[model samples]
Target: MRHLKGGPEPDKHMLRRELLAVRNGLTTDDVREAATGLAQHALQLPELAHARTVAAYVSVGSEPGTLALLDALRERGVRVLLPALLPDNDLDWGAYAGEGSLARIQHGGRMALFEPVGERLGPDAVTDADVVLLPGLAVDARGMRLGRGGGSYDRVLARLERAGARPTLVVLLYDAEVVERVPEEAHDRPVHAVVTPSGVRRFS
Candidate 1:
């Protein structure tokens, strides 16, 4: 910003706006095809193959589709934990039973999110995950993620750290979202890898 010496590298806020705009511009078919491809690639990850538990989220709107992946994981007998947004912007964990168990919740004027309909598992439940599927607008060459400006996942990461849970952290994204640079804060941690429709890119 104005405080930078030469200039500001593209901050996370700016990157998020640009990436989200592109996602919003995609056609229905574009989103659908990408979703299928995403599932195929993600399923191939060895991390997910041996994972007994995974912490993931339901993709909303034009975000890379995750419902397909979620179903596949369940079919594979992986215990998936999904997040429900709390009033304080923290997350509450719950088990993903199936599509029938989800309730669409409209948070204030924000976009509606699909969360598990029953049996809240409390926040610390994420410590049980073998892998954590993060939702982010982009991941840079240095592996720093550009999130949606909500600190919810950041909180999750912090909790995992405090619990000494070393789950493999992964982020799902469209191919173009793998970028060369993105802003980072002191609290930001690099994800272990990024799964794109084209392939999986490991940063760690």
Candidate 2:
């Protein structure tokens, strides 16, 4: 696969530096504003509006906002699924009916919110999703995503591709995080598009 250049590889040290830089340069208000704008842009995407089912991540750390968009999607009658990290670090998905119905499940080092409404399929379940909103530490113009060093999403997306999943993979980020390039591994999964506070841009 073709890769872009310039952005640093997101190793632990680089990630720490970048995170600190982001934290120092942006205030809570700035983050909230950017996240709100990015969420709006994502909601406005035609792919998101037309998607019958979507797989989205529950934001951790300083990622973009998703709560309002998720509620909006539910209001529009869309089926939403959130990733449930399994004991072995693989992803098990369950439908997200609403916040009240969600139960907390422990996996990896974090808690995943889940509902018992949908089929408890393994990683291949992503194949049935119309859209997949992936969480990332950083993303570049070429669609290269820098995950948190755990290959979970990459493995899941690879499994979906092997199964011919046509889901539109989208990465959400703040406008400043969208750079010219991001370091990538051979096994990294490429996203279809990226949404930032500025707007949605398709990756070539």
The clash count of every prediction, one per candidate, is: 0, 0
Off by over 4 Å in 2: 1-16, 20-28, 104-119
lDDT of 1 by residue, 108-203 (tens): 999999999989999999999999999998888778888999899999999999999999999999988887777889999999999988888898
lDDT, residue 157, candidate 1: 94
TM-score of every model versus the real structure: 0.95, 0.83
Candidate 1: pairs in clash: none
Error of 2 at 141 (Å): 2.0
Candidate 1, superposed: residue stretches over 4 Å from native: 1-8
Question: Tens digits of per-residue lDDT for model 2 on 99-189?
Answer: 7656655455564444344567666667789999987766776788877666678778887879888899998877666666666667777
Q: What's the CA RMSD for each of the models?
A: 3.9, 4.0
Best by TM-score: 1
Worst 10 residues of 1 by lDDT: 1-10
- The top-ranked prediction according to lDDT is 1
For each candidate, what is the lDDT? Answer: 0.91, 0.74
